[model samples]
Target: MSTRRFFAVALVVSLLVAGVASYYASSHPDGLEYVAEQTGFIDSAEDSATADSPLADYQTSGVDDARISGGLAGVIGVVVMLVLSTGLFWLVRRRGTDDVDSDDARPEHARQSEA
Candidate 1:
């Protein structure tokens, strides 16, 4: 499939999974957190540096409604991921050929020598 089509599908799927499916995610702690609690070390865990950030804890801070907060956080996360991934890919693709001579710019002598 074309690159545009592929990216469009990817964005849609990402938004759907993050925004909609996240609402149904289990509220209970997962394996690591559960184990920590079971082992009696859960209280020792330090809060993340981002703990005070608006989007911390998978939900938007200060939002009165839980559903809206989580959904907004999910969509924001997806958009950020897409932007970062695309930027990294673009940087990688542009790195190697920036100063290389194009076919039309090669000297006739150089071209003949390579031939």
Candidate 2:
């Protein structure tokens, strides 16, 4: 299949799985929190800068619904990571690619095209 079709199928499949998993997820604290509680460290846990973050605790502030909050947090984390990685790559690339037309470091085809 073409790139578009492939990506579409992947997205649909991923969404379907996510929906099913979300529907079946337990409302209890996740593995880490459970471990912390069992180990007697949960009470000592305090908020980090992450605590104030929009996606903190795998939930948004004021969200009463568990599944929605977790899903929203996951989505937000994905978006934030995508944006951050793209931004970092662009910044690094911009410095190198900005003057390809005028840069002597470029290859013959680029120099010829620019000329």
Candidate 3:
């Protein structure tokens, strides 16, 4: 498939998983939290600096519906990642050279030594 078509399909799938499948994710604490609780260190765990952020704890702030809030947070995360990754790729691509095999492109040591 064409690059554009491939990216379009990927983006659609990402959005669907983020906005729909996320609602079905397990509600229990993740591995780290579970381990901490079992080991009796849960009480010592402190909130992250970003605890007050709207998307903290995988739910949007002030959203009464748990499913909607989690889904929205997931979608926002996916979009942010997409934009950042695409921009990074664009920048790295711009710095690449089209020439693959050229003696002039290599350093002097890369060339065969004169007899």
In terms of lDDT, which candidate is strongest?
3
Summarize candidate 2's per-residue lDDT along 52-85 as a digit string, tens digits: 8776766767778877777666666555665798
Clashing pairs in 2: none
User: Total clashes, candidate 1?
Assistant: 0
Q: Candidate 1: minimum summed lDDT over ten consecutive residues — where? A: 95-104
lDDT of 3 by residue, 30-107 (tens): 999999999999999889999999899999999999999999999999999999998999877765544444546777
Q: Alpha-carbon error at 52 in model 2, in Å?
A: 3.6
Candidate 2's error at 90, in angstroms? 1.4
lDDT of each: 0.89, 0.72, 0.90
Model 1 CA lDDT for position 75: 97
Global Cα lDDT for candidate 1: 0.89
Residues 15-71, model 1: lDDT tens digits: 998888999999999899999999999999999999999999999998879988998
Cα lDDT for residue 53, candidate 1:
97
Give the range of the ten consecutive residues with the poorest summed lDDT in model 2.
14-23
TM-score per candidate, chains pooled = 0.81, 0.54, 0.81
Q: Which residue pairs clash in candidate 3?
A: none
How many steric clashes between backbone atoms does each model show?
A: 0, 0, 0
